[model samples]
Target: MIRAVLFDLDDTLLRLNLTAFIARYVAGASRLLASVARTTPVALGVPYVRAFLAMDAQDREDSLTNEQLFNKTMLEACGIPLDDPVIADLMTYYEERIVPGFSSGVVAARPVPGAREAIEAVHDAGLICALATNPTFSLACDRARMGWAGVDEKDFALVSTYSNSTRCKPSTRYYQEFANQLGVRLEECLMVGNDAVRDIVRDGCGLRTAYVGHGRPRGAVWRGPMERLARELPDLVARLDEQDA
Candidate 1:
């Protein structure tokens, strides 16, 4: 009955060159970490990339939260001891200070034109609203980007982050866990995102998708930009409810 609407953050709610941003972010982080450790950024950069890839692999049976996996892998790859204080310091500094500072120099990171209004439409329909961005970053990192997207953290019922989520997106398990957290069935949620393959569920996952990307994908029931979504979402939600009834 469309009890919840899950929104993807990057490229969907926030318009930015994601690849470029990742590169810049990794470079900045490497430099910052190297300065503290008295090592070369190049040394830190290699391990950071490896750790990120390990997190993003989306293993269905893994029990660890993405944050735990990231930390474990990052430290192991860097050959640092498990009890090192640097990990804690790095996490704190990166989340609290470094990420927020990126907003100024990164001109490409801007809120999608109608993203906020689209969120409001979900609220107006009385549906649970969730930020279902890939759970590869901390809540602080997600919140910082959400601020750049002009959305308030207070508005969402669920905000997926590395510490909270066990699986990455494009895996049905991620959506399954999200719905379970919201106390709803998968069929009751509609995923709204720009990536066709990553956001859309297949193989009888039961969730429907609304693609907001450039071209229509096979599984998406609706296709349009965020502006159109803002205008039409209530009606669409109503339609889904009626169909369910």
Candidate 2:
């Protein structure tokens, strides 16, 4: 039986224009780092962008956490030492101030239709509900985005963040890690998300996927919008569990 429901944050539970958010986020970060690094935002953005993209290259067996890898790559690219005190200040300012600021004005992050109800459905079925967003940012940033999604951190049993996760999404190890956190077999979890590549898994991780993206993608055992999921998830979960059994 499926004991947990792992929901992706950005385009799944949250109606986020991830591309736009990333662009704005980069701009904001560049502006902030420019002042500290004594360089123009345009000049600093090059290395910043490089470091950001480096986070996407997941290792099957990585020693460094996503945050650690980001810090290492960023410091190397920027010629900043690992022990630099400014590093702490930069991270603190970014997560506490800059990331929270992204919620309003241009960043348009909001809840997906019926997202809250879908979460409620998971709980009603007595399943473990986790916010399985890609762990590229701090937990504070995740919580800030959660506010935009009209969800609370308290709602989830596990909220994946850069501090806690070793890998990024689309990696089967990332999926397996969350299952491990819930103390359940990977096969006992249903990953619900809108990304065709990140949400669906064909590899032998034993995790199942229910895609809520634009089209029916390959490897998804189920497909529907959040509204349908809200109404039907309990029954659907039971059916999937029974089928597997």
lDDT on C-alpha atoms for all candidate structures: 0.84, 0.83
Query: What would the per-residue lDDT of candidate 1 be over residues 98-190, giving only the tens digit for each residue?
Result: 776676555478999899999999988889999999998878888888988999788899999988888887888888988899899999999
Question: How accurate locally is residue 119 in candidate 1, as Cα lDDT from 0 to 100?
Answer: 95
Cα lDDT of candidate 1 equals 0.84
**Residue pair clashes in candidate 2:** none
* Clashes, model 2: 0
**Model 1 weakest 10-residue run by lDDT:** 79-88
TM-score for every candidate vs. truth?
0.93, 0.93
Q: Pick the candidate with the highest lDDT.
A: 1
* Candidate 1 wrong stretches, greater than 4 Å: 81-86, 104-107
Per-residue error for 232 in candidate 1, Å, reads: 0.6
Residues 146-173 of candidate 2: C-alpha lDDT, one tens digit per residue = 9889999999999998777778888887
